[model samples]
Target: MTDSHDASSGAFDPASATIAVVTYNRSGLLTRLLTSISEMDPKPGHVVIVDNASSDDTGEVVESFRDRIGTTIVYRRLETNTGGSGGFSEGVRVAYELGSEWIWLMDDDVEVIGDGLAKMGRWAPRFRSIQGRRYDFDGSEFYWQYRIAERMGIPIPFAPAGFDESGYKPMNSGCFEGMFIHRDIVRQIGLPDPRFFIYWDDQLYGWLASRKTQSVIVDEFVLRRTREIKQWDMGIRHMNASSNAYRYYIMRNRAIMKKYYRALGVYQPVLFGLGTSLTFGKELIRLLFVERTVRGTSNLWRGLRDGRAISRDASFRTMAPLTESVD
Candidate 1:
């Protein structure tokens, strides 16, 4: 990695960006990600790892890298696992407070390769855009845009067209893994919604950010990671094929976003709600009968009825209690 110096002060200059990685009970995977980040062509100025109350030796893994890595590494161990929303909320808040010009929000499981960060830094001069990795489950390479097309019930295209040597395209949605965001844009729009405990949290931030600035998908940046598998030990299969959490967020957040769109007089909420409900409802039914996970289905119903609410006294430490097992 190329190290630059501050001309006037004769001190090693910190990069303009900071990377915030949120992890829970994935110590091994988190270590790999940290190592990969440390080897980036242009190293980040700061790497903040938020351990979401992991019972394993996650703290030990981070400490191991304290001496080797050049960038400042700040490890904060939460008392509990506050889901993705809370973890991401706290991570981004800290990045902004530290005066980061840009924040790269990432999940622990994802790994970035090649000159991804350096390429992104080169493109930083272009408008403030939210950029994400082109990823697929396991080893398969798939366009992240396929999910958006599927959600909209549109035919999937073979590949993105009109690409130059630099891979760049207009994107409506993005995965949280390796998403680069400008600090100024986040300051104006604020943080991710903490109420969304699991799903759709990143989309909420992306959608809101799009209103004020542009959002893009950088094909060159690849966040290679496996698609989540429904394991028996994972307290809730938030991303499982049988869980209703996906449907619930799609319904409730669609409702919430529709209201915001309507207030801005941009689009009708009825159409958006109808589309989200129909798609998610089909998934919910499959989970109810085929998967037979009763708790997952029940949570869906509750989410739809309750809507999204921010509790006055909510905190990560409180939501995710320090327990031996999530069960």
Candidate 2:
């Protein structure tokens, strides 16, 4: 898991790659992430840091690393906080505009091991996008359910067993941390959606990308997350223990889920509709017995109503690509 690599087995141009990291007010964690990235072997050709109008010392941290890091670090600060979706959109647009052959992306808190990028760079040309394994803060493997539910086209939380480490598994989903994608895929699917504002954006984009080409989740590369893991019933872990606002997005994006199913076939929507009803009942029970929040019931009703209405509306617009408005 160090700098050791056997590129003779599969060599790729490391210089043709660019990295896009989106950050908010997490300057302290960003320092560690950037440091690890700076130390990556055959470093990315360019490193783009999209700061979403952070109020902290993120700018100063970037400046300090500018001279210290071994790569060309480009820091772009937005005037407002546009969330992860917006930040990644603008960052990727910039990377694409800069003419990079491959674009690697991550959040502010991930630490990239040198060998991960080296391995991903070697396989950059093979797939549309490649995802590396992520380790939790406790050094345990994270994102246990890497498999996207074949019927629903959503990630289901289940760990796979007995996979060959040397081979790749077909993936219809993606995580920003340690995700490596070719520029051509960007041309086909466009940049990641900013209007998603946060949750489900990556999955939607991953779905779109996979529709046009092949993407894979492989263990050849790796990334480690530094966060507290939250677990739920039935071996379920909320890798992202989201907030009320995030919950809103989670519910609202069901429209996106509906849209995805509707595109597949006539029966998919019917199946998904039935499945959603069951899920809604389970959620209501969870809120009643487990959560019991003061306004949880009202909020749940509002979210479900709005989400379904959003999906049913005729004017619902898919998130437009930031690259389309690139200046």
Candidate 3:
């Protein structure tokens, strides 16, 4: 699907763009993601891969594709796993250091399905932040994103729908996969908060990006969602029910997000905290009746309690070397 926006003063040059792919222990999946990049119609000029201290052979997998992606590959492995938030933060930082006017951020599990990056490259110059569309495992549009609460920093569910593939619709927030953000926006708002550890990191960053400049979720498919699709209804689901760690982080991060929204100068603490508590209740019910996991239940309870304290003294760290010398 080819969508076009009016050309701005500066036309796009592939050489000015850097693609950041963050991966964990999934070597095979990372290979497919990099392979897809190698096959893009107009490939990125530079690619940066950040490994999240995986026990698997992630380094060898990256080395195997070093010469074939048709770009300069700068691979860096973190000393430990800092979740998706840290990986993307480091990846974007390295891309900026290596000279990138535009940074395209995504995870390694997805595969580029079309000439969408080339299309984004053509349109990105006109806007500060650009988000491409994504499809699920069933080739259905991944519809859980695009609607973010402006005041509360929470993700709200809308009626499932599709978008017209011809316009760049305005958005309050978006996900990391297929996100085309400008260097200036990063300089202005700062990098994705690493303190988030995982959940709410991208949404908070996207919300900040929207505040500073023109950001939109374009109606164009770029990445095909490779992760398992959840059976969710109105955002009511088990929420990684088997994984107590995910429940803990997402629950704990909700309080962190509340503080972030407050700092953003658009927050109503009482209303937002109430709404967040209600959302937490849904996950609790799912954790109990749906998953029947005793451990998840305890994690959920502690998360709710600990999250309050977390909000009381929340802090966000920006990436160092905030401004790149490359223009």
Candidate 4:
């Protein structure tokens, strides 16, 4: 689908709109993402790539695109791996500082269907309506988060069938990979809490933002990518379950989230903590007794206990770096 706008009138140019992408060691994936951005319509005013201390040649790959892409490509490399929350927080800060009026935050692995920026540009005026695209990993099953929402009968605001045009209503926070946030909203709500480190950071940001502003989903634009699932348990071994890193962050940040929610008079955090404990406990039993990883179970038990602690720091060095090639 194509959108037309008169160049002389500057109708489609939403001043200061930028695309912010966060990457960690996935040089190949970053290259493909840059190519995708190069092909986007109504070209973004700027493109910022936050490289989280990759040991790979990610810097060279980004440098190769200096000429072809229309928007200014600003590459900022961090000194260490700070995970998604920190990377995204820095990316948004950079984009906003670079005068971006609207920021499109995306993961390195995501692929735009076609003219994604132009679609966003044409739709940018409706900044109050934050939109995200449907994501399908492996081009088969939808992401587990979406499936879980469907199972829970939670009304997905951006289903293909369309939703009530009642402006913005509160809904569960979706993944950050395919989401676009208005600059004004981010300015008000601030960046994702860095203490989160990983899981549920997007949820906290979305839920907090929704209280003051309306966020919606754009059903038309779809972002597709191949997700690598490393099986540590049995079902699907995505990043969250494969490494001890996942358990640590899940426990620590969950406690933090519970604290924040309780402070805000939201009672759902207790249920959330219970659900996480039960789910991880089952995984521990399977990995320990069935898979014979007694050490893994011990680590998980510690994680669950520490997760409930209000003052515990979850950061730790694991066996391997919590990253994989995007290809």
Q: What's the distance in Å from true for residue 250, model 4?
A: 1.5
* lDDT (10s digit) by residue, model 1, range 25-114: 988889888888777777888898888999999999999988877688988788878888779888887777777877888888877675
User: Residue by residue across 175-240, what tens digits does model 4's lDDT show?
Assistant: 678667665566656666666778667766666556555455554454667455443433443322
The window of 10 residues in a row where model 2 has the poorest summed lDDT is: 1-10
Give residue 218's lDDT in candidate 1 (0 to 100): 61
Query: Model 4 clash pairs?
Result: 16-101, 230-237
Candidate 1 worst ten-residue window by lDDT: 1-10
Better of 1 and 3 by TM-score: 3
Number of the predicted model whose lDDT against the real structure is largest: 3
lDDT of 3 by residue, 34-115 (tens): 8888898787889899999989998998889888888889989999998999988888778877768789999988998758
Candidate 4 similarity to native, TM-score:
0.75
Please say which candidate is ahead in lDDT: 1 or 3. 3
The 0-to-1 C-alpha lDDT of every candidate, in the order given, reads 0.63, 0.72, 0.75, 0.62
What is the C-alpha lDDT profile of model 2 across 1-327, one tens digit per residue? 011122112457777789899999999899999888778776888999999999999999999998778889889999999999899999889999888878888998888887776878656656657777788787866654555665654566464633685677777777777678777677666778776687778876776667666677876636888655444444444433334665566666666667655654533765566555554555555554445544454554666677878677787555443443456
Q: After superposition on all CA atoms, what RMSD does each candidate show versus the true structure?
A: 9.0, 5.2, 4.2, 8.7
Per-residue lDDT of 122 in model 2 = 58
Evaluated against the true structure, the overall lDDT of model 2 is: 0.72
State candidate 3's TM-score: 0.87
lDDT of 1 at 320: 23
